[model samples]
Target: MEQLFSKALSVSVRCRDSEERKSTIRVTIDLQLSPSAVHKRNLHVRLTDDKDPYFLFTLSISEEDFQSLKAQQGLLIDFGSFPQKFIELLELCHSEQEAESPRFLLQLCSQGPTPEGPSSLSVVETNAFKHLNHLSLRLSPGSDREVKDYLASCLARLKEEREALELRLKRTEEDLSRQLSCTQQTLCEKSKELEKLRSEWTSQTSSLSSRYSDELQSEREKALELQRRLQEQADQLRQELESAHRSSSQQLRSRVGELEVSCRELTERKYKNESAIRDLRMKLVAAEEEGQRSKQQVLSLRRDNSLLDSQVHEKERALSQLQMRAAVLEQEIKDKELLMSRTKDVLEATQQQKVSLEENAVGKDAQIKKLEATVKSLSEELLKANNIIQKLQTEVKSLVGKIKVKNTVTVSQEKVLQETTEKLQSAEKELHSSRQQLGTKEQQMCALKEQLESTVQKLNESREVLKTNENVISWLNKQLNERQMTRATAPEPAAAAAAATSGAKSPLYPLGRATLPPVGGALSSPADLRPTTQLDVAALDSKYFERVDSIPIYGLTSHLPKEIPRPAKASLPSAYFSA
Candidate 1:
């Protein structure tokens, strides 16, 4: 029917979608381009067996083709066209079961891109199955439950990996501490070297006492000899002093030899002492060089330490931010899970509704078929009955003519009686068959009613499920709101807890003490929770004291001046109120 009623022509097709470029094509029906009035340029594609060569309209596009040869997609063929051709193609493609394939046909028609051009639209050469898979994945964002679970599992694994990374960082910090301790030991050893050098100098000075003692002994001996010589000088001038002079000369020679020995020993000792002093100086120079190197090393170490500290600080800040983000993600996951559950509920309801609709459609179809059959049968029977009446009328006219003309009434009556008997039997048989058919139809109707009742019960179950889902959604929403409120003011509870802990630790207040007002609406911002020491310091600002005398702070607090400077930092969380 399609081939006889319509004409099919060859066309070109192309479709391109990429992240880098976006293109949309619209057809122009200008005669200059189309040229042919019989142009099937407005293509409505029918999908046939993929293996068939004629199934595809091959389009030749250049390798550098950038423009999407497509129009707005309205079919699964990767393009769209006029509805007439669309329906025709659908009918051809699913001739065996067009009714069952309406949805599939509709989807194919809708998802196909709209084309624009008079040139031949070639068949899209890509795998149709692959495209269908792509569509499935794209739609799976809402439809696929397993994907969500997989994502959740992945996130959990990532959290574990992060925790492991943190452990590694802590281990690295421990190694750094050990390295620092070794550096400190090196510094201490360098300090000890200077102390040892000072001690050696002190010992050298103490050793000079023996040399001083030897010098004192030699001087005393020389003075005694001189005194002896002076006393003998007056006696030697007189006659007969030759023996005394000889004794004195011998004593002088021995004394001179002893002095020569002592001088040689003193020279040796002086050389040894000078060498020791040079060695000490060398050691001092080496120590000074080492001290300079150590100083450089310390400076570099300090720089490295500072750099590491900054890095650590930055990492810690980043870690805190990541933790906050993780918390946010966790909350998001909760919300998503809730949404998934809601979607599940909606899907179940829609499925039940679809089932009910299918059942109703089936029942309507069955009824229409039954009515059509009854109408056809009745029409056929009416026609047969009219023919029978015409035959009977002709027979009655013939029989009357025979009775009047031939006087054969008895013979004619016998024939008439026999014909009437046969007719009566035929009518009774028809009546019995009609009654049986009516009974069968009635039974079918009752069965249909029972199926409908069952369908209604299923529908009611679906409604109840929907109501339960609604209640769950409401509860979840309430909880979500409460969670959001608590999260927004997270610091308040933390600060309050910290203050209480601090008070307890100081032994100045009892544990669990409530400092806030019983009925409270305390500020929740970071500034509001900054340390009390900061608040006290701000309260002492000159501007704050400026109007202290005029300002009321309980009557006992009148010691303040008229005014003082306001707090240096307003603090982001702090809000000012007019008196």
Candidate 2:
């Protein structure tokens, strides 16, 4: 495993140039180890490939430490050799200084006797070089004393630097708090504007829909009244026709009864005349001839009665045919009424579509305005962040200049002067690190700007989509209206009703997802209106997708950029101690 670890070991260190006099020189050291070693140490290593090297660690140290460490002798001088003793010492320092940053220290020790105390400053002792006696040398008593004194002076300077850093932190905190309050106030104002717009939009939509419904209801009532009148007229005509037929049949029955009585009386008289003629023997032949004439007359009377009955039957058949015609006319009128009702339904549907489109258009305008406002707000925020970053950079530069001036002035003070110069260097390094952090913040701001631009692009694409949808809906509505008008004018009631029903079933307003607000609710500044769109979503409905409201409009809410967290107050002092 050790052999494999050695083979896999690949580390590189990069140091920033000292010519720039940048306080802290970033030294990046990358360590790659073998799989066996990684598993044994339980290291979180990143590997390029299974057969390739795995990166185990990357650490940053100051340029001065890098130089001093490189100038050392023994096995530590070899870059490829793993410094187990040095890693142990760093771990020990970290454990001891868990509550505070570990101070910078350079001390030498040999593999002679193990250090006996749990002191914070313990030098690393190598145990792998037993064959080299010179490499096992220890620190002399006099050098140790000098090293302790130097450490004491350095510690005193660090305390002073810490005090200065605390004052700066308190001032920065006050500034940040004030800025945060201002941002919060602005956000609240935007939210209020959005709420007002939403309320107005909802009210308008409701009013329009209610008006259309009322119109539809009134039209339906008129159609019903017309149908009732037509039905009444048809019923009156049928009643009159029935009464006329009943009176005519009654008159015919009376005439038939009168005719039957007269015929019976005539038959009796003929019978008596026949009996008298028989009584007279002399006129036998004459009586016989009279009887034959009477029989012929009776047959002619029977034929006339049959003709009257046939005439009565024909009159009744004509009346029945008239009644059938009246019933058919009534059915036709009823079908026309049904068709008229269906046409009204179609009209209502079309009107509803128009209202929806208007609402959508208004909503889109509002959303666009809202987005613009949000963009403006974001731009303002970016400007603020940039300003802050600039201020920080300038402060760092000024601090650097001050440290330089101090170092030059302290040069003549002898022992105290040298100690002050070292302290100034440490302070400069801290300032440099802070500047680097500020640079990082500036980069974050740039990324945020890029995100805003991307969101704007997406919003534009969405607007285009809404426009196309609107056009398509309008065209469809036009076609439906035209078709309905034609059907309403058609004479065939059944055909008209069928056509109207078909039209009514066709969708009036096509459903679409939109993130924009309605246009009429415009506030003073178009740019400031953007935040309202986001705020309106939460206010409108918690579950819009599952509600009837979703039928009309849906919008993807664009989230705002995350704000950077405030920096800690002790960071600068901790940075100094680390240096």
lDDT of 1 by residue, 494-536 (tens): 7557654654564332232222211224335423332333112
Off by over 4 Å in 2: 1-427, 491-495, 498-579
Per-residue alpha-carbon lDDT of model 2 for 325-402, expressed as tens digits? 999999999999999999999999999999999989998998999999978856775676566557656765666666
Clashes of each: 41, 11
- Model 1 misplaced stretches (Cα beyond 4 Å): 1-425, 491-579
Global CA lDDT of candidate 1, please? 0.51
**Which candidate wins on TM-score?**
2
Count: clashes, candidate 1: 41
The TM-score obtained by model 2 is: 0.16
